[model samples]
Every structure is written in structure tokens, then in C-alpha cells.
Target chain A: MIENLRDAVVDLVYLVCAVVIILGLKRLSSPRTARSGNKLVAAGLLVAVGVTLLDPHIHWRPANIAVMLIGTVVGAAGSIYLARVVPMTAMPQMVALFNGMGGATAALVAVAEFQRFVASGAVTAGERVSVAFGTTVGSVAFTGSVIAFLKLQELMTGRPVRFPLQIPLNVAVVAGIVAMWAWLLGFAGSSASVWIMFGLALLFGILLVLPVGGADMPVVISVLNSMTGLAAAAAGFVLENQILVVAGALVGASGSLLTILMSRAMNRSLANVLFGAYRTRAAG
Target chain B: MNQEFLLGLYVLILTIFLGFEVISRVPTLLHTPLMSGTNAIHGIVLLGGILVAGTAENPLTLLLGFLGCLFGAGNLFGGIVVTDRMLEMFKKKEPAARQA
Candidate 1:
């Protein structure tokens, strides 16, 4: 009886959280209400996390509880401190840094899930695909955002970094990732293959963002943001979580739309922002 | 292909359209906040981290989960707090202060 009740409560809470998230997004449409909207969304997330702690699936062992407590406290306190202290001039890098952490988290979650699937030795093609997609996309977003942070922070040259045959190199890296994806799903399905794919994806991300000039950081950040959301959604599929699916898709859509809008504001297209890297330098 | 996936698909598709509708109206001035807000939202992956970490059976997965939790928390809190700071800038009104 308690199990059934718990299941029902979980379902109900997830549904409510989804609605609250959507409402929060809606409220963000206007600046006057955006702060409150942010507050509502934060509250909703808090409830979601609290409820997740009660999930029957969680082992709640001392080690597990320790990990959760220590991780959350340190992470939250560090971010809050940085957020409060960072000057307005550094906002772009700040966003990029935080977004990178989110992407890395998504990728790690997918990696953990893949490990579980491998240990069980009963993986399905669909599960493999989701895990592969999440890991690759998340890894790309992670590294890409970090590079963007570096460029924005002026820790590296903000000018577009280009090398001989950069386009071909990137294309080759992408093709390799696709091949690995197929191998993981079709034959090998090993954790080692996943790591290799993860590494390649990271390389691709660096290549993807490295050639863009500093002036175009907004578009680069937007694209990486969308990629992170898509990755989170893929992680959702890997874990079969409805809230992840809904929240991830919502973020993915927002980032994609913002990317388009920002690019349009610059009188450029999405493809141009992403792939037209160094074209101006070459043409000039 | 399964029922769960199909349902997730439906939800995903609907949210995508809803995302477009909701964000289409935000002014350019607030784009940064919007981006950061959504960034914070995706930190929902922290839940995934917690779930995996709570059930991890091996050292690697445990480490991954722990990192996930740490990073996810950073994303969640940092994104929100930063976006709020940005929004607070717009909230300050000069005329009221001048009158005072």
C-alpha cells in the first residue's frame, strides 16, 4: 500500500513541478516579472530535489548521503559566492562557466548510466543510443563552454583561433564520433568506446568554438547552451525521467530560439554563426 | 518506442513549441537573464547526479555522481544568482531616487 501511495505521490509531484517550471518560463517573458519567475522556478527545483531524496530507488547509505550533502553544500556555496562577487563586466564568462558545469554534470550522468547498463549486460539499442547521444553532446557542450569562458575571460586570445585545414580536421573528428556511436550501439557496447567517443566529442567542441571571434560570443554561448539542453534531454531518456524530459526540452527550445534571435539581430544566420567562423578573416 | 519514451516524446515536442511561444516576446534587453535562467533550469541534472550517486556500486560511478552533484549545484545556484543580479540592475529606477 505504501509503495502504491509513494508512486502516486511521485507522479503528482512531477506533474506539478512540470507545470511550475512552465509557468516560471512564461513569467520570464517579461523583465518586470522575471525575478519572481526565477524565484518560483528555484522553489520548484528545491521541491523536486527534496522529493527525489525520498525516492525508494535511492539506497541512502551513509556514503551516499555523505556524497550528496558534501557535494551540494560545496557546490551551492561556491556558486553563490561567485555570483555575488563577480562584477558586471565579467557576466559573459560567468554565465559560460556555470553553463559549462551544467553540461559536464549532464555528461557525467550519462556516463554513469552507461556504466550501469554495461554492468547489467542487458542493454538495448535504444538505451545505448540515448546514453551515447547524451555523453557526446554533453561532452561537447562542456568543453566548448569552457573554451568560451577562457576566451571571454581574456585568458586566451579572443580573436578567432584558426589553423591550417581546420574545417577538414573538424569534419574528420565528427565522422569519427559518428562511427564510434554506431560501434557502441551495434557491436562493442563497451564503456571504453563511450570514453573514446566522449574524448572525440570534447575535441570537436574545442574545434567548433575555437574559430569564432570574441564579438560572436553570444551566439557561441547560445548554441552551446542549446546543446547542453539537448544533452540533458538525452540524459532524461537514459533515465526515463519525465521532469528531465520536459525541463530539458524547454531549455533546449529557449536556447535555440535565443540563438536564432541573436544571430538575426546581427544580420546573420545560425549556420553562419556556427560554421562561418573565420570567413570574414579569410575574405578580408 | 516504448510507452514511456513516446510519452516523453510528446512532452518534449510540446515543450519545444511552448518554449518558442513563451520566449518570443522577451525583449532584447533581458536576453542575458533568459539565457542564464534556462541555464539554471537545466541544472536539473543535479537530480540525475543525486540519483546515480545514491545508487552507485563502483568507485568511478560514485566519483562521476559526486562531480555531477557538485557541478550541477554550481550551475543551478550560480545561474540563478547571477541572473538575479542582472535583473536587479534593470529594476533600479533613477527618477524615484532623484525625487528623494
Candidate 2:
């Protein structure tokens, strides 16, 4: 009875977090309520995380806690400084980098989950498909966002990094990704294959984003955000976790809308944003 | 096909519409801040990172989990903070400054 009650409480808490998150997103539509909405979303995350820490299945130890604590501190302090110190002109780059972090997390989870499967001998075909897909998308978001960040920061040129072979190279990388996906789904893929997929996807992300100039960055970042959300959603499918699914879906939805709105605001089409490198006049 | 997968699909379909409806009305001036805000929402994937990290035993798995937690935390903190900062600037209507 106690065990069932505890499980019920956990599930209920996750639902609460999910609802609060939705409310937060609803409030975020207007500028006036946006900060408070952020607070609400943060509150929901806090609750969800607090509850997760109490789960019996998690093997918490001092070392693990230490790792988490250090990460939290660095992330929190670094952002607090970014908010305070970084000028307004650089906001988009900061956003891109932060979005990349989310993608990296999803990719990391996919890898970790696969390692677990390898260890336990419980690997299933569907599970492999989801992991392979999630990790590829996640890797794309990670590397692509980094490239976006570099350009926005002026660490790299904001102009299209065009070369004669750019299109064909990108096509080949993408074809490689598709082939690897098939291999994984066919149950013939090994860990080596998964890593290869990850590398190729990252390369594909770079190739895709490299040719777009700075003027297209807002739309590019927003699209990447949607990709990260989809990767997270794929990760949820891999894990079969309800809260992960809900959270991922919420991000995916909002990110896609934002991408559309950003492109419209720039008066560019999706195809233009993706491939219109010949139009140098579009650079801001 | 499976029940859970179908349920997830249902959730996904509903949320996509919900997102479109909620975001369509936001003004252009607020677009940047709003994008930053949604960026924060996705940071909830940090929960997955924490879970994976906590359960990890092998060296590679542990390293991956640690990096995931780091990245996820960075996303959550940095995204919200930057959005709040951007929103703060938006609230300050300058009397004579040019657009951002």
C-alpha cells in the first residue's frame, strides 16, 4: 500500500510540473508576464527535480552528488554573469549557446542509455532505433548551435562559409546519416556505428548552418531549438518516460512556432533560410 | 501502434496546436525575448541528465552523464537568465533611442 501510494504521488507530481510548464508557456506570450512565467517554469522544474532525487531506483552517492553540484554551480554562475555582463546586442548568441546545451544533454542521455543496454543485454530493435535517431538529432543540434554561436560572437565570420564543394559534401554527409539510421534499425549497427552516425550528423549540422549568414541567425537558432526539442522527444520515446515526453513535446511545439515567426519577421521562406546563400544582400 | 506510443503521439499533436495558438499573438518586438523564454523551457531535459547520471556506473557512461548534466544545467540557467535580461531591456521604453 505504501509503495503504491508513493508511486501515485510521484506520478501526480510529474503531472503538476507538466501543467505548470504549460501555464508558464501560455503566460510567456505577452512581454509583461514573461519573467514571471519563467519563474513558474523554473518552479515546475525544481519540483520535478526534487522528486526525481527521491526516486528509489537512482543510485545516488556522494561522488554523483558532487558532480551534479559542480555542474549546477558552473551553469548557474556562468549564466548569471551572462545576464548581467553580456550586452544586449549579443543576446542571440547567448541564446544559441544555451539551446546547444539542451541538445548536448539529449545526445548524452542517448549515449548513456545505449551503454546501459549494452551492459544489461536487454537491447531491443525499437530501442536501438530511438537511441540512434535521438543521438543523431541531438548531435546535430549540439554542433550546429556551436557553429551558430561562433558566428554570432564574431569568433567566426558571419558571412556564408561557402566553398565549391559545400553542397555535395553536405549531401554526402546526410546520405551517410540516413544509411546509418537504416543500419541501426536493421539491428546490424554496433556502438561503432552509432558513433559514426553521431560524427556524420554533427558534420551535417555544420554544413547545413555554415552557409547561412548572420541575418538568418535568428531563424537558424530557432530551427535548431526545434530540433533539440525533437531530439528530446525522441529521447523520451527511448526511455518511455511520460514527463520527458510532455516536456519535450512542449518545447518542440513552442520552438517550431518561434521558428516560423522568426522567419516571417525576417520576411524569408523556410527554404530561403536553409539554402539561399547566393542572396548576400540578406546579411544584416 | 503501441498504447504508450499512441498516447505520446496524442500529447505531441495537442501540444503542437497549443503552442501555435499561444505564440501567434506575440508582437515582433517581443519575439527575441519570447524565443529565449521557450529556450529555457526545453532545459527541462536536465532531469533526464540527472537521472542518467545518477544511475551510471561505467566510466564512459559516467562521463557522458556528467557532461549531460553540465550541459543541461547550463541550458536551464543560461536560457532563463538571458531571457529575463532581454525582457528587462524590452520593458524599458527609451524616450529617444533607436531600435535594437
Interface RMSD of each: 1.0, 1.8
Q: What is the lDDT of residue B57 in candidate 2?
A: 80
Residue B29 miss distance in model 1 (angstroms): 1.2
Question: For residues B14-100, could you state the per-residue lDDT of candidate 2 as single tens digits?
Answer: 877776777778888777888888888778778778878788786677777788788888888888888878767766765336564
For model 2, state the Cα shift of residue B45 in Å. Answer: 0.8
Best by lDDT: 1
Candidate with top DockQ is 1
Candidate 2: tens digits of C-alpha lDDT, residues A170-238: 879988998888887775677777888888988888888898888788999999998888888778777
Report the lDDT of model 2 for residue A90: 91
What TM-score does chain B alone reach in each candidate, compared with the true chain B? Answer: 0.89, 0.87
Report the CA-based lDDT of candidate 1 relative to the real structure.
0.86
**Sequence-dependent TM-score of model 2:** 0.92
